[model samples]
Target chain A: MEIVKKVVIAGHFGVGKTSLVSRFVHQKFSDQYLTTIGVKIDKKVIELEGATVKMMLWDIAGESSAMKIPKKYLAGAHGLFYVFDLSREETYRNLDTDLFELNKSLNGNPAIVLGNKSDLVEETFIEKLHSSIATDFKITSAKSGENVEEAFLQLAKEML
Target chain B: MNLNEIKFRPLEKKTQVIVFDQKGKVLETDNTLVEVNPEGVNIFEDTILCGMEEQFLSLKKGEQVELDCIHTDFFGKESHYDFVVMRLEEENPSYGLVIYDFGAQYNQLFDLQQERNMAQIQSHRLERENKELVDEKTTIERLYNEMKDDSSSSQYILVKADSLLYNLDFKEILYLEAYGDYIKVHTENKVYVTHNTMKRVEEILPANRFFRVHRSFIVQLSKIENIEQMSLLIRGKDKVIPIGKSYKSILLQKMDQL
Candidate 1:
């Protein structure tokens, strides 16, 4: 049987959460920054072994505080992607607190942490940032489309 | 203790301590308290040790345990916490607790549950709509098939010509002629003229037995004596009917050998 899963893409403003979603869904990227207003929903179906998974992705507008995120938009989410911009120190700096706040708001769902815009940063710096954070994170560049598919697939696998 | 002060502390140092009675009532707490309440309500809600009062009372003297629970605030923000509980012998409270906040993890699971429900609703709606369309298409196809069977069985028909009616076997008719607003059906024994256009004449005739070879003629396939290059000769009629270029392929298609 085919199962439908709802996944949420969330992060701080300009952290490339929308960029990561666009790259994964449409396989295209733009350098221009188009801020998401409230939420944008897109659908994609992944073929699994003997079953198909239709994922309804909710790309919510970025915010520093989890409380500012509209709770309704996050409703019915199966999994979550917490993305941060690697080029910006502040984005990674607030990762722990933001994730804590998100955890409280979401009641602790399964989530994948992503460090986006990897193409703009040095690997050593990214590695250092990765080690400092307590969770396993995937470094990605939405513009370069690196590790975007793997991150989603990992979430999907965990969900299954 | 002021938990808000510890909220800003470094991640490594952010720790919470709570002392509760065997009944799971909050007696005292350290900097880990999420909400400040002088009312001192019970920490245990639906889970924890709320329903298992007997289990808490019958625990061994040095028993230690870990448990998780959800705490909802006035603003409706729910925080999840994991606690390690140890039976306290010297302290005023019977239980000493060390708490670890895991509210984010709980939030993620709740969101997943909500999303699954929404997806199931959408899938069900689409399935219902699809079933309705299939039912409608099947009903239309069944009616068409029944009508086709009825037409094929009707090999004879009554031809109304003016005030008189002529009973003619469709097989005996050679061809039809379009004359103004009337159609002259030519048979070997006699001619029957009716007040109807050739278009209407073609509609009533069974499609398998009649072939409209030209704009002014519809010939019975079995009554054809011979087929020439662009014309056909009727079995007993002296005149040959010309075939229209547009309908020439259709006539040839009907004459194709098995």
Candidate 2:
């Protein structure tokens, strides 16, 4: 028996949280301003662990100030996809808060730290931050389509 | 790190002279007589040899006798000393008794004071060192906790297979390996490669769990099956990772401790 899982994408404002999943499921990129108000959902049926798992991914807005997510949208999430911007320190610092709050909302939910905007930051700076946190993180440029799917795939692989 | 043998030395036999102040309490005990020129009995005489002889002659082995001991000044003043105190009857009392009082025994007081000071200094140094060892132990414990947490917690590494999230424990990861732009994460089960550099990928993995073996490879030390010279053999992959020159010594020392 196989049960479908819900994976939520969460982070600070304008960190391309929505674009990461949209890019993964739709395989498209656009310079568009679609601020996710409450929650937006995407469905991707993929072959995982010798079974067909339909992953209902929730792309939560990446606004740091919007700390509380209403219960209506915060339903039954099994995993988390945390995003952060490389150029913005505020976004990175808020990443902890995002993970913290997301964990509070969905108790014991697994997460993947996604490092967005890898195209701009140098490899040296990224290497320096490598050993900081315990969670796994990956560099992906949403605009460049760089390891975007790998970041999402790691989220599903480690959880399922 | 500079260790100069910390061995203990045995006490040596010595000839002693006990000096007392006006109060009759023994002030200074010196081994000058017992150590050298035992035949010279008069140490406070007109000549240096006589003065040495006088110090020895002033005391008799079994006689509890006090004589008029002369104390002199460096400027050649013939100061008459009242004291030579000896226990003519007792056999080796814990301390030789003061049977006589001589010229001001101020120099005797000064010498004993210096010895006391040296013992205190040695004790103070040991106290500080003990405190530092306690501090070092605390630091080691803190680091150990950090390492344990990193290994046990779930790490979200980017990968090509979406389902790898459930299969691997982040702590089981030994290292990240780089092959050009594609970084392969070699864990217990299988090796997964994604479009990433080891440097960039290292940031995503726990620093303590996955060490950067080379620019092309990062290996989990816990999972290393064997080390053949400069190469490390990971379980799954036929290809071996090289042990870098800079990291070789530290790796060897740590492996030995394990």
Candidate 3:
């Protein structure tokens, strides 16, 4: 039987969450900025050694510390992706608070921390962040297809 | 009728009767009555009548009391019954308890309630399914538009400019230019700005009729007036589009030579 797992993709506004999902799912990228309303769902199947894992990806709208994340969107979610923009410092500053709220709502599920928009950021700053953050964080460029697949595979493995 | 004239009267085999003395003691009972209290004042499923016990015992001579109650029979079957208690005479008054069978009406009420509950559940289910159908329609429509954009045989293309959809023929397009987050479609009489990438524009435009002359421009092959070393002029327009050095040979190879 194929195991189906729900993964929620969440981040702040303009943080490249949609771009990352588009790159991974469609292998396409667009420069135009489209704001997501409510939530969008996509599906992908991963082949492991003895199992095929079907991931139902829920791309929710952007949430800040002030905005309340709708609880219905997080219902029955097995994992999460908390993305931030590498070029914007404000998206990084609210990472801890957003993760806290997500954890509280999901009762502490596993999550992947992704710093996107790496194509527009300085290499030195990204390298420094890799050392400061204790968890497994990936720096990705959704625009150039950099480390996008690796981050998804890593999350899928962790969920397994 | 006389106070003692109201003796035991026979009822249907399944019907239940309980005769109460002036002080509310059970004087007699039907053969179907089971599980009577040891004191015989109240019987099985009498819980519904507990509140009216005071009024039952205080009934005066020649007075009557009538009410409806839900009751369970000796076989533990339940039904609604019209209950009437009457005091026959003033001398040595006694109360007669007569229960009218309402099993058919009670069953009809139960059936109606079941039907109403089913209707409510069905209504909620239909609402949820309708929303799903609408969502499916939207997805199909978006996919259809994308498929049309990907088609190479079509002579017309649907373009969105300023949030409005326009179905323009391929010949009307002079050339497409890439802006930051928008594409400017320069036509014969006007320029329309739309949110799209140049890569997407290339996919939508027919490859045989259009050529990617530069990173920022896709020009119609039929509309090219003349090609300079660094720039090319399009018909019916004064603007010159720069040709990329990498695309120079491809542009030349695409031309029908003598």
Candidate 4:
């Protein structure tokens, strides 16, 4: 049987959600920042331990607030990658509330928080951010190719 | 009109209708937008439709499920649609999947959204730049204040020459000349060459005492012995510094004040 799952990459605007998708899907990185207008679907087939899963990556347009995201975009989403910019404190200050609303809309779907642009911040800053947030998040840098693949693979495995 | 001769027009021009059984199998389709498979028309082949299976199944008789802003690309041309799934009430009930193409309106909305988002990004970048400028100004003010408070440490400007730190007093310095990616600090008895720029040296020196007479030269006002045509003579030195056309008026005004 062919297993197919939908995963949505969502977060605040200018949070590098599109960059992460481009890095993971195309193995390419661009310094340009282009805003996504609507949902873009990309597919990748991952070979798991005992099963092959076709992961449909739905890169949704970022909203200023997680509650502002369209509910139609979250329909049938098996997993979600909630991303935020590491350099911007405003992006993650409301992480708890945003995650609460997003999870409510997802009906308790599995999600992973990602702090992107790790290269722009120091290790001490990352530690401070971790101490401040209640949820555990992976720090990634799409520009430097840091921990991007690992994060996507982890989410794909979780969905499986 | 006779019942067999009567026909109904579609509600939309670019529309697709797919009828499915309760088991999620495609029973019939007009094949307008959706591509048909050789074996059968399985609506589940589309990722968006496949994902909405649970929602479609939960619809009761006469109930409808709407998913808006669904995007699709056919042969390199992008299109947007609004999907409505309704369950029909009958003995052998079937489901209807109606796709209404609203690509034109959605494209307009996308353009507006793009413009708004770009403007937002520009605003954010400007805000960040403004904050950085504020921080830089604060630091410069703090340094200036600290220098002003310490009288003994304030009069001397520190310059590095040949890997040695030279503390030259403000009065002893006559002028500075720009020397190829470096500045030549001319003092009373010695000319010290330092790796610096004229603008930076001018910024560090007091505005009232030191004046930039030209693009490449900054002269101490107290050291000017005589002012000539488009040039000035420094006291105790025969060197004549050419005055820039634009700075001539400002120099004359400052000299008159002095």
Tens-place lDDT digits, model 3, residues B1-258: 532354445544445566666555666655354444526344212332332445556778767776543333323444555566777656766577766666676667656554654464356558767887999999999998777666644578788987799888888889999999999988898888999999988987777788999999999888998899989999867889999999989999998867
Restricted to chain B, the TM-score per model reads 0.56, 0.38, 0.41, 0.53
lDDT of 1: 0.71
Model 1, B33-87: lDDT tens digits are: 4553425566443223332344455555568665543332211333555556666
Candidate achieving the largest lDDT: 4
Model 4, residue pairs in steric clash:
none
In terms of TM-score, which candidate is strongest? 4
Order of candidates by TM-score, top first? 4, 1, 3, 2
Q: Model 3 lDDT vs. the true structure?
A: 0.72
| DockQ, prediction 1 | 0.02
Output the TM-score of candidate 4: 0.68
Q: What is the DockQ of candidate 2?
A: 0.00
Badly placed stretches (over 4 Å) of model 1 are A1-160, B1-27, B30-120, B155-158, B167-172, B179-181, B203-209, B221-228, B232-240, B252-257
Clashes of each: 16, 49, 0, 0
Comparing only chain A of model 4 with the true chain A, what is the TM-score? 0.96
Identify the superior model by DockQ, candidate 2 or candidate 4.
Answer: 4
User: For candidate 1, what TM-score does chain B get against the true chain B?
Assistant: 0.56
> Cα deviation of A59 in candidate 2 (Å)?
0.9
Using DockQ as the measure, which candidate wins? 4
Worst 10 residues of 2 chain B by lDDT: B1-10
What is the DockQ (computed on Cα atoms) for candidate 4? 0.32
Full candidate order by lDDT, most accurate first: 4, 3, 1, 2
Task: Flag regions of model 2 displaced more than 4 Å.
Answer: A131-135, B1-258
For candidate 1, the per-residue lDDT at B164 reads 84
